[model samples]
Target: MTTTVARVDVVAVASPKRRRRAPGWLAVVPLLAFVAVAFGIPALAMLDGAFTVRDQATGATSYSAENLSASLRGAYLTALLGSVKLSAVSAALGALVGLPLAQAVVTSRFRALREAVLTASGVLANFGGVPLAFAFVATLGNAGVLTRHLGLTDKGWDLYSFWGLVIVYLYFLIPLMVLTITPALDGLRTQWREAAQNNGATTVQYWLHVALPVLAPSLLGGLVLLFGSAFAAYATAAAMVGSSIPLVTLQIADALSGNVLVGQENVALALSLDMVLVAGLVMAVYLPLQRRSARWLA
Candidate 1:
């Protein structure tokens, strides 16, 4: 009788737990619905716009490849080239500068100073756009404080130049890379380092054999993020250099504003192409690196 009663009690306890877990999956329904409504709708609209054209005679919409093709040859191509160049350069610089900073901070004895630097970097990473543009201009533009003090009134580098944009971008890029790389650095097992040291491995050998392999995925991920951020960025580029620098985002803005290229169908197509190209590039780099990382981490 006691054994039977114990079995009955177990069943009763399990019943409510199973029932409670059922509703947990239902919570995802709202999130999925939200994404379908918000992201799915907008993404489809953008894709549809890429192929849509307006009839000059009747003002009716129709499909046209010529619009997308024309953009591919002119402003779209130029903007893409510029974007790639800018992103690549900035990411390279970030990685070069950030890795050392990450190493220093992670291995530092001065924890307070390291924390302060990390906090400052975090603040600056999010501190781009109009205010950043104005700040740079105030310090580096014509008749600015630094320019005036250094007697560089005429020869002072204008904040409206390509290199100027790069410099401003670097201010944020370096900090972002450091933030991303630091987590990877922290994940490095001290055991592995000690093992390598005990095995009579040189510092360079240890880094090349163990640290680099382990950190590869995080490094690649950071580079991809940096590239994507730079590529899609508009505010800093627009505010700092305006359309004179001829970036892809500026061209898109111009298309919308001026209603250029026949009802601005080209703008949508151009943006689609831009997104697709970036997606493709990132995937190309990420998939191979991810596979390698998985294998290594296994």
Candidate 2:
């Protein structure tokens, strides 16, 4: 009897998706360096200042939570909470109103109209800050043309109020949401809608069962973007209302100028840290949702 021996071999295969080229990585160095210089260093310094305290007489330095603790109570806490509340309310309103408006623009049969609306959105999205505040003041302030014409001021319209700020924010934020969500709306496959229809799904049913589930990530991502925009905003609020409203950004300004927080301490560093933490939290939620949405849209 003749016996044959068989040899077995194993080979490891690398995935193309996991492979990285040296030059592609090299190209990212400049951007990484810029971020390190522009953001990382300043952030590190701010963090150091926030924790470190120096004795006025002895010149002895020690790390402490005094500033941070101070910020968590009284006016500083109120400002922080106010910022969060404003961001949440404005973002929610912007999403609610802007989504249907964006959808309407997307579904419209007129190409020219769609193009015009999108171009306007692009322009308006960036149209904010002092100029925006001024525009609103001129149009909706106590002495504004529309206010005078419609007698809104007599009806108790106050432009400096929180709700007024929401209305002002929506001016740009609605357009921003439109600009932000349009591409995602476009990514929605017409075939999916037709398929849903083929399965005897009504308009409401299709949206409820299919469209909304797919769009949820994008919607949430947009909400976070709006939140960040509203949260970090300073100039418009500063110019419009000054310290009339307790905002974290306004508190930061006051803390820097020796204006003294309600408890007679400067916690600018601590407040900055707080803002950074809040922003970081927003990003923590935003980045993953954005990545997931991008994967789906792609």
Candidate 3:
């Protein structure tokens, strides 16, 4: 009888525990709903529009790969390639420059100086769009004050061209990379350096093997982030270059605005699909690198 009562009590305790655990999944429901609304629905719409077409005269709807296929050729291809090239260059340069800036900030003795630089970086990283474009144009454009004073226009500096766009992108990308990599730099334990020194490993040797390996994942992830940022940018490029530069984002705008050509809505959708794929690819690499870096830093 005593054993039976003990078992009954155990069963009663387990029931409450199960009931408490049942509602735990409810916390994740809102985030899942948000993802479905924000990303899933738009993705499905893009996929549907990218492959399906409507007849202009007959009003018939049919499914075909023509829109997507078309996005891979001619001007579309040029825009896609140009966007990729720009992203690669900007991302690469941002990582290279930001790494040193971040290191300098991390190693600085002055707390106010470090905080000021970080604060400025946070603001500048988000400071893009037409305002940013116009600011750069005013300072760097062919007839601007700086351009006139510096004689950059005389030296053939064209703000509406590819290289000028690169410089503009770098302004934000470098700061963003600094913000992304600074945490990883801080997570570098002092013990590691002390241990390296105890073993007669010079600072260069210690960083070459110890620091770089640990930082590699974070650096790559930051580069991917910069790439995606530059890839999807539209307003800045639109305000600055218009159709002079054949970026994919600019192509999509032109296609959707109906100012360039007719029947380009499908092309716009196709290009959006391409962007989604590229973003998905970027996330795939970034998430793994982030996880790996977290393991080391945490």
Candidate 4:
């Protein structure tokens, strides 16, 4: 028995085959191709033009920074500053108005009410450009129904002025803020509030100490987004006020279409580059704040 037991042995071996995985890169190819065709090509072309200049006499093309330099001078600078100011004002107004609306929606007891508010916000956020401008003009323009009935024009309320443009911008900007900030409001944990209450903190104190601190990043992110939206806007302002507003976007349109100057196509590209840089800077600040907000939210 001992001899037979000593001669017997068994071993198990693992399989060499591994599980097959679908190629992840393959899934992204379509998106990459679309971006390349739609965004990359245009951006490259603009960049090339931005750094290029054409000789007026010989029609020769050469690389130079004159276009970039030109963009920072005279009316172009004024337009850029005007766009920034408009975006800043609109974003501030939107945040101020939309925050309370978002809070009200989030704290509502009725599910239908919340849904309706969110739905309305979604619609209004995208309800921009020509249609929005037309609506505002119809409602607030000279010979408008309200203006005719209320005699606002008699009080010197011009619908095509800077303040009027701000009012029109607020229509969409507030809704966008509501949409963006609603999630951050919803993410305010019940436990945190309860813990604050348990520590003898009032509602106002809790909001000041705990809720606002957590929400700061999200709020800043939303403001930056709103700024970007207002900065890039063209159709609404164009339709409502034509070239009277003197925004960077309007300037770009003018340059591109030769409405202002015939040989400033390269300047238009440079302006586009400037817009892109500003948007990129906004996102650069936004991304970090967004990440921090996500961490707490998660």
Give the top-scoring candidate (lDDT). 3
What C-alpha lDDT does candidate 2 achieve relative to the native structure? 0.89
lDDT: worst 10-residue window of model 4: 10-19
Q: Can you write out model 3's per-residue Cα lDDT over 164-230, one digit (the tens) per residue?
A: 9999999999999999999999999999999999999999999999999999999999999999999
Q: What are the Cα lDDT values of the candidates?
A: 0.81, 0.89, 0.93, 0.92
Clashing pairs in 4: none
TM-score of each: 0.86, 0.88, 0.92, 0.92
Off by over 4 Å in 2: 1-26, 57-59, 261-266
- Model 4 RMSD in Å is 4.9
Q: Which ten residues in a row are the worst by lDDT in model 3?
A: 256-265
On a 0 to 1 TM-score scale, where does candidate 1 land against the true structure? 0.86
Q: Candidate 4 lDDT, tens digit per residue, 133-158?
A: 89988999998989999999999999
User: Model 2: per-residue lDDT, tens digit, 44-97?
Assistant: 999888987767678777889988998899999999999999999999999999
- Model 3 has an lDDT value of 0.93
**Clash tally, candidates in order:** 0, 0, 0, 0
Candidate 4 TM-score versus the reference = 0.92
Which segments of model 1 are wrong by more than 4 Å?
Answer: 1-14, 152-156, 280-298
Q: State the lDDT at 46 in candidate 2.
A: 93
